[model samples]
Target: MSAQESCLSLIKYFLFVFNLFFFVLGSLIFCFGIWILIDKTSFVSFVGLSFLPLQIWSKVLAVSGILTMGLALLGCVGALKELRCLLSLYFGMLLLLFATQITLGILISTQRVRVERSVQDIVKKTIQNYHADPEDTVAEESWDYVQFQLRCCGWHSPQDWFQVLILRGNESEAHRVPCSCYNSSSANDSAVFDKMIFPQLSRLSPLARPGPSTDLCVVSAKSHIYREGCAQSLQKWLHNNLISIVGVCLGISLFELGFMTLSIFLCRNLDYVYDRLARYR
Candidate 1:
């Protein structure tokens, strides 16, 4: 084949491979959205506690994934078959997707503070209602599960629970902290501001047996409790994963841009290729 033919062939195959990747990514994202929507676990409810828009986000993911997969199928078929009409369609869809991404990025950046405040308010409300129950209501149960999973206390610290009914000497679940906050291990657990739990942590009294779901514990020392707050733990985790997160975003952006470029190049050259073939015919 001529040099021009070879270049065209390379573009076609590269686009096919890239669209295959897009199909896989889109399928995975679509499945994740479905999982979040149908989730019966404490995880989604726990997330819902702080972010009320979690459901909307899931829907967006589903729609975005569908659009991506659809576009990828179009791209793959167009590149492989060298169909100008399909290539044109693929290019237009990619342009639309790129514009939507830019719009979303701008909106998120501009409204970030408001979003953060909303999340903070919701988290505070959730903290105020947390009873460390695994079967109480969805919100309460989610908070308990998050504490257990993250191995952290309240939103900011253990003191964030001091305003609860039990803390004010009213009849409630626990007096000091939720049982979820009680560390099961006896290692170097206490931070400078952490509330430690007593090694002999148990039910409020010997006569009081552990309930089927919730545990009321009498904490004497703050050392046995998870001193760090969930907020701090999450922040640290995000910080640790920031590089990977940014890298993924950049990679995705580059891939999409390349797809657009490849489609445009193929669309512009197909006319010439057909003209040459016509002369030979």
Candidate 2:
């Protein structure tokens, strides 16, 4: 092959590799989104749904993934087949995707405070209604998981558990302050936090029974439960992962830009007669 032909071949293969990476990345994102949408564990609900559009990050990720994969497929096909029309379509779609990303970045940067406040508000609300029924609601299971994993209680403090009616003076599920509040080793042993099973309970004496033992018991729990809130933890997590996030964004931007340039070059320089004859032979 001539020098020009060799160079064109290199560019074509490079684009193939590029689109392949995007295709894989897009597939992962799409799968993750579907998992979040269908997930019954509610593990993600503890982070609070607010600030972002649609109130669900999973859906957003899923849609973005689909778009990325679709455009990437076009790019792969265009480069491999050396089709000017497909290349043009790929370029246009990439441009649109790039613009959308830029707009989203700007919006997030400008409304940082609102987003933070929204997170705080949502977390607080979830805590107020918090329940530890993992088998039941997603919110409850998620909260239990978070508290257990983080070794923390409540949104801002352990006292947040009191906000729940059943945990308080209510006769329903009394004397229990979520198994998550306890350390993992002792979490399953109900003997630790059991308030109503006092030795005097068998006596049935009013003096021995005492009054609202849960109120004082939960107060002592403040010592064992997590002191930090999920909002604060989430903030730290974002800060810690900021570098990776920025790197991914920059990488995607550069990839799209390269795809656009390469597609344009191939379109402008392609020899229609030679390409047609080569295909037949």
For candidate 1, the 10 contiguous residues with the lowest summed lDDT are 192-201
Residue-wise C-alpha lDDT for candidate 2, range 1-281, written one tens digit per residue: 66777777788888878898888999999988887666523423434321112225578889989988998888888989988899899888878888999999998999999987886676676666654442233455456656656667676766667667656655553344655566535445555434412331322233444342222223235334456666666667778999999999999899778888988877776784377569889
Estimate every model's Cα lDDT from 0 to 1.
Answer: 0.71, 0.65
TM-score of 2: 0.63
1-281 in candidate 1: lDDT tens per residue? 78998899999999999898888999999988887666624433444232123456579889989987999899999999999899999999878877887788788779988876786688778777655454444565456667766888888888887777644454543447666676767544443113212221222234445554353343522547888998888778778998998788778778778888999999899887898899998
Off by over 4 Å in 1: 24-68, 106-111, 129-150, 164-180, 186-223
RMSD of each: 8.4, 10.7
Q: What is candidate 2's CA lDDT for residue 197?
A: 25
Model 1 lDDT, residue 191, Cα: 37
